[model samples]
Target: MKILLVAASAALLGLASVGAASAYDGTNCRAPGNCWEPKPGYPDQVAGSKYDPQHDPMELNKQSESISGMEARNAQRVAHFKKTGEFVYDVKKIPAE
Candidate 1:
């Protein structure tokens, strides 16, 4: 009975550790943009400024541009469809034009 109780306790501890490790990596963000690692080349501040090795502005800008352009195009298409009474859109044509 004691051995069984000890085994159950060990299993519970292992489960808790696993859950902690998964809190960040399981998120949607991956690659340089979302993960941070310290680099030695950068300047160290007197106050010890925070360093994020995952800083990739290019990827973030790409995501932002893609999302914004799609949203704007969708809005324009909706407006055009309302005005022209056409529910269908051409894949080859630009939105609202």
Candidate 2:
């Protein structure tokens, strides 16, 4: 009887997993543009840590913006290196010789 019950449960779980396709991408909508943003202070009440990056839009945006700034700086550095064969962290700060 236990073996039969276990087998049935396993089969049900397998079928359930197969049916689940899309996952919640923080906005509750799989598509873009029309995503519903959660009300401020609402997500904080959810049963999770305040620092969970997966659900924290502010954190994710902050990180993405920081990365973009870093990439821009890196691109500038690479361009300067290619043009001058030297790496200068801040070209403006270096006094013109």
TM-score, prediction 2: 0.37
Q: RMSD to native for every prediction? A: 11.0, 11.5
- The TM-scores of all predictions, comma-separated, are 0.38, 0.37
**Candidate 1 structure quality by residue, lDDT tens digits, 1-97:** 9999999999999999999997767345556577654355756553454553565789779989999988877776777778777654543464524
Model 1 / residue 14 / CA error / Å: 21
lDDT of 2 at 88: 86
lDDT of 2 at 90: 84
Off by over 4 Å in 1: 1-52, 91-97
Model 2, residue 40: distance off in Å is: 30
Query: lDDT of all predictions, in order shown?
Result: 0.71, 0.74
